[model samples]
Target: MIAEALITLSKPKVKISPFMKVSNSSNFQVSEFILKGLPGIYSWQHWLSPPLALLYLSSLGANLLILLTIQQEPSLHQPMYQFLGILSIVDMGLATTIVPKILAIFWFDAKAISLPECFSQIFAIHYFLAMESGIFLCMAFDRYVAICHPLHYPTIVTDSSVFKATVFMVLRNGLGVMPVPVLAAQRDYCSSNEIEHCLCSNLGVTSLACDDRRVNKICQLVIAWTLLGGDLCLIILSYALIIKSVLRMNSTKAATKALSTCSSHLILILFFYTSIVVLSVTHQAGRKFPLIPVLFNLLHNVIPPALNPIVYALRTKELRLGSLKLLRVHKEYR
Candidate 1:
């Protein structure tokens, strides 16, 4: 009996089933991701490279010029132009975050991104995007104060206030987006390591995981709606109040001035939100034509960066003159 008991103990109380599935995801986890770079347009990725590269170049040049102009012309250092300066930085960062990788994918077919690099890219992309969203909200508030309460604008949006707001924006957005990558990192990506997008977005990568990603998906959605949605709501509210104030002005010139002050910003805002909305819609409803959404997503990131500075320069007289002065100085130098 003693021998049998010892043998039974040695044999194990229950036989282990070799056929049973054991989730050793760490062993089978994907080490790298193959960025597919726009489904159904595989043959034409080459053609898309030049335009995208040009867009990135334009964004970089325009934003750099804006930064230089703002720095050189001390008079351009008000809350409005200061906000534009911040926006330019955000736009440049956004373009820089994705465009290089996109060009590599399009031109060289260098689509495989390792897990760590992929996550890092995700962090940067999300961080800048969130920062841009918050900056726009700040810009809207600046406009609101300028147009609605011009008398108190200086007091409310002083250099000190702008500095504090910028600091808060940086910290809030940076901290808010940190969790997105962490949640993505926690997911087991053993199903397939192919990302359907040009970049390693939180949604695109998390969708490739084999495990239950409900939490990841839900967290991403929550973060998006909370940050972007909240900013958008406040922007709309600020504009609404501005419009109300503008309408109350009896002078046509005053009304026109107020509306004109908002026109450039509204254009950029429209471009930003329209692209996002169309991209989201294409994802849900235009699945049959995948290229449309993919291109929209790329455009959404690249075009705003390129066009924002141009729009602002064209609309704002000070910026236009500053650009001209810089051009003259360059001509004189050369």
Candidate 2:
């Protein structure tokens, strides 16, 4: 009798009702995610592949040309061109990280991305963005030194300083943004596996988590503001100082020439930062129009890289001449 009672006690005590349903929550952990590209336009989404592919190719070609031109020309080996080279590399990386996967989803209907791969994409995209912001800051400082303290420019902005700045850029962004992907990846994604964005953004991924994602969102905001926001503020200050120095010049011709040097940089900065600001505002406002923001995000990645080399080549006489010379030399060799 005692043995029988022990056996009954060893078995789990349970109460079953006719209305009770077995829970399937244990099996709901997502293994992969589906990228729903361009919400509300699934039928005609393939049409976007052609123009986007063209933009990607143009971005790659233009950045490559700039890098090659900078590498070949000894006279263009100043700190300014060195920073341009770095920017071209960063732009290529930033464009390449997202555009190919987007094209694949559009053309081939391969929207399934493994969980690990998705997180990796998140990390890469954010890292490249932070690096680009850092490079822009460096460029702005270079301009300030060139304009405001012309005599000290040679000593202050040397090849050694550029190298140090590059090191700092890599370390700062790499270490800074590492936690974004980690925080997203650690979440329990049991609710949904469908991401409604073209790329694996941190917010999109974290929002699908079954648990609280307030910490993830907060971490992302903190890092973004610390890196991108900090860089932007410093860049603005540098430009402000540059403007003040230019105003102090007595000669109108001298002032015009100084301001002319910064015009291209200003234009590029506006293009880059304006899109980011608009995207952020739209996201925070909880706007109903999703497609516009998605398209703007896609265009923001490709358009700047495609235009950067062109802008510099057009505005700066030296780059234009170098590009022409490089093209001519290649043609003659062929």
Candidate 3:
């Protein structure tokens, strides 16, 4: 009886589910997570799939058209178009990183995401967003140089310089945003496997961690502000200088043309940053309406991408003409 009592004492008092695994440290780790997508609309969630998929398809189509237009047009082989091409690629990546999985959750009721996949999505989402911000900053600088120092623009914004800037943008954002997912994955997620958000955002996944997630939260905030906020500030400064230079132009026609060139970029910037600000405010204000923030987050990922090429095409004569020529050529070939 004493031996049996000792055996009983040796056994763990708590029951561990088969779904969870014991790590080397003997902590129960979650292997999968359930994404509770858009709270309080379970029955009608499927209705969202159509519109969401349409947005995704539209983003893909429009961005692809932009890329094709840039690639095929010899006249557009300039730094501006090159940066626009990069922006299109980043926008496509940003939308793709999360939207499909969201669609799956809505369409097929596939809400479970493996732990590794979830973390990967987290990394890709943040990485692409950072890249987009970096591209925007580069574009702003490009505009500033073109407008404020037209003579120096040719020397400063050369093809080689654009290539170097693109490389830097890729490397900086990749290295900078990598820590977010890595840090989130390191935390012990023993408390819950149900993520409240539609996607595996750093905050959404980390909030379920049983251990203190203050570090994760702090890391995300610091990285976000450092990357996104820093880029926005620099962009604002660039535009301010551009405006100052534009206002000084003696010819009103020249000033209007210069400002017209920047209008499309400014519109895109507003769309991207405004969505981010609204989402942040919604979260920080502790708004009781959960769906509002989720909708904003979804719109932020899809709307900018869908609108980017369209906005540029509508505002920029070169791109609009080039797109028409490309379509005509394709039609002729067919």
Candidate 4:
């Protein structure tokens, strides 16, 4: 349903490398293929805003509830909950960065973002991605402590350790994700810039190139696997240790309860990573399967942030009760 003028601009005769060739007709010799422009993808973003706004509102409310409950309930103010607080803060950033923009696209017919706005989106998304990955790594270590050293959980995961871990996570993600923006800025875009999906993703940015993109693609692949993959392996190791520790326990009920406590965490991590991996590898190494990567990114990165709290908090008893207590307290004061 594209206009003929836009279609004409969509394909320029350039000499793109074979890897970049999605569909090469004898007539269309693109040096570098221009991906679709950014105008239409978010054109109806205003319509998309309401649902995303609701999601952010809900996540914000739930996180606030969790944060307040953790502060008020003496029993909940442990190192684990402290990390949960940190997670909430990071999740807030993650949601804040994306949801409002998405909402803007939905609520208004105009969906154009300036270059700076686009860059900001890229930075925020990568920053949050790094934070989320770093936090999960921290969370794994937290679980390792709780399960493996029940007697020494308090002494081990102390305030200082937790604080240091938080700082480290932020710094690591910041430094680690810093390269992407620098690399992305080097690429040139002419007419084609519209990404098929919402959000400013590296893949989307790289696709708009009319120059060599192999360097970007390789950097992306390396960073993606290195960060996310490392986190996943560490988590797996932590759980392996956790399972060993759980089996060592004499009481079956207690063991079951402990595992159950982490079930939500386990499930959420699986969903997050699985989507991430699929999204990473699915980008059209070939031109024909273009929409697959788009769908993958949209589903995994966008959808899971909203679903995270639902899986983590709503179903977990401590979080559920904590929410109730906060709500009840607010009702009483009113």
Candidate 5:
């Protein structure tokens, strides 16, 4: 009823996006106008959101538990745990940014996101995404410290250093996305903001500009390549050094122990980076599997955070036992 009411009451207002410089651009006239909410994407979201919401929420819960557990138990307050907590926060922020909005469309067919909202989503998602990649790089460095500089690790990765690194990432990524939305505002609107995807994705939104999107496109290209490329290079280098160190270990048992710790990190790295590479290479290249790539992007964007707890934290004996202990203490008191 609310959806129907909102849809009926809300008359779509027409305005030119600032970046769109097309002459005579107005509602419904531009070749590729960014539309405010259309019902088409919403129709599909109805059937698709429940399962996705479950998975995202589950992951959110797990990550929150992990963060809290690490904070309460002093033993877990090392650099590694702090970095893991930062990652959990970023993952939670990243998933919440995209999924719930889509779910709302499914529940209520009011598919109209204002231009401001669209820009907001773009800004938030990209910022967190950059931060997520940066965080992974930090994780790689953490692993490198444990393996390569075991003697000096305590000094190198102190809690103060971890705090600074987390702050810098959040600030840097948040600032890094400024050009996207700021440039998007210049586009002139022609009233066709009907994005095919259920999300207010970056490229999809950018393509709506009636004016030359060269500025925004360059920003996207620069940020994508810089962050993605930098992360990949660092990860590879870290692994190479790690392998070298592990090889030099005197005892097989010690080396095996080191490798075991690495196994989970490697799995996550593969999942996150490979998905990114595949998505970037295939994006709008008119590849045969556009929908498939979207689904994979969805996975890359959300599933890592959802599966992260299970993949890295929940599987750990210490975290698991600590969580159970906390739960039992809470239940007994209740």
Candidate 6:
């Protein structure tokens, strides 16, 4: 009897209920994501750190200088410079959103990020890119008016107008990109918790999910075409009109002068769009080689920010002279 009692006591008791059942299905949600940094080139990650660190520092320092220059010089507080200031801020945001995390992964081997933070990074990436596109469109419009309608340019792009345009750009981009993170956050990631890219891009993270991510992909494409595509179209149209105005000028010198004013802006726009196109083509055609696209994506984020100040601020005569004067003043004070 003692032996039987001991056996009964040792037996596991099962709680059987209609509501509680064994689950064969997997849990398709994740609390954290492991960032797989450049899958095949783990050894080269440390090597990549030096150049990337240089770029991050250059972007931050250059953008900050431009911002401060504009703030100190009252004469430089025009519509075009104001837009460029906003662009600088956007570039800083773009660099900050990606570089620090990338550096941490490279230098410290810090790969894991919580889901909420990952989503926040993705949101910032998309938001800043959208803002850049919109600001480019505004700059194109500014150039068009300054060249095409010189008399009305000042009145048309007044301080109030610039303020309103800035607000619209922020609101439009912020609202338009709101759905991207939402869709991405709803994804089920049972198969993997590893994003195969350097940064938390929308498609990169969504591709890691186990469930159907068609909706997420579709939303991404829709937002891209809507924001980027629309901005490109408007910019092209503004340039077309500006070119038309320049051609109508009787003297070749006058026409050249008109086009010269737009040269810096055109150069910046060319760099911006060329990188974007290369990134797209790499994503589509270079799928067999993933690192190409990843490198381009990283460069695209950093290079433009690093070059913007050089192209827009330092290249312009007013800004260059003002920077020199400001430096002289600072030296005298010191």
Q: What does candidate 1 score on TM?
A: 0.90
Tens-digit lDDT track for model 3 on 43-108?
788898888898999999989999999999999999999999999999899888889999889878
lDDT of each: 0.84, 0.87, 0.88, 0.71, 0.76, 0.84
**1-334 per-residue lDDT for model 1 (tens digits):** 9999888789634332231223574445466789989878788877988888888998899999998899899789888899899999999999998999989998889999877788888888878878888888988999999888999987999999989999999999889888888887777776588877898878778888777878977887788898988999999999999989988999999999889988999998887877777877876754587677667777777788899999999999989899889989999999
Location of the lowest summed lDDT over 10 successive residues in candidate 2: 14-23
Tell me the TM-score of each prediction against the true structure.
0.90, 0.91, 0.92, 0.81, 0.86, 0.90
Tell me how far candidate 4 lies from the true structure as C-alpha RMSD in angstroms. 8.2
Top lDDT: which candidate number?
3
Q: Write the residue-wise lDDT of candidate 6 on 186-272 in tens digits.
A: 766666777777778878888877668899988988998899989988999999999888888999998987787788888888888
Q: How much is 27 displaced in model 6, in angstroms?
A: 3.8
lDDT of candidate 4 over 151-270, digit per residue (tens): 988798899999998888778778877777667666665446565555677767667766688887788678777887788889999999999989999999989988987887888788
RMSD of each: 6.4, 6.6, 3.5, 8.2, 6.7, 5.8
lDDT, candidate 4, residue 94?
Answer: 83
What order do candidates take by TM-score, descending? 3, 2, 1, 6, 5, 4
Off by over 4 Å in 1: 1-27
* Total clashes for model 6: 0
Q: List, in order, the clash count of every candidate structure.
A: 0, 0, 0, 23, 18, 0
lDDT string for model 2 (1-334, tens) is: 9999999799875453222222356544577889999877988999989988999998899899999999999999998899999999999998999999999999889999987789889999889888988988999999999999999999999999999999999999999999998888777776578987789988888888877899998998899899999999999999989889988999999999988888888888888888889878777643587777677777777788888888999999899899999999999999
Regions of candidate 4 where Cα sits further than 4 Å from its true position: 1-48, 285-292
User: Per-residue lDDT of 107-140 in model 5, one digit per residue for the tens?
Assistant: 7655667676777888888888888788888888
Against the hidden true structure, what lDDT does model 4 obtain? 0.71
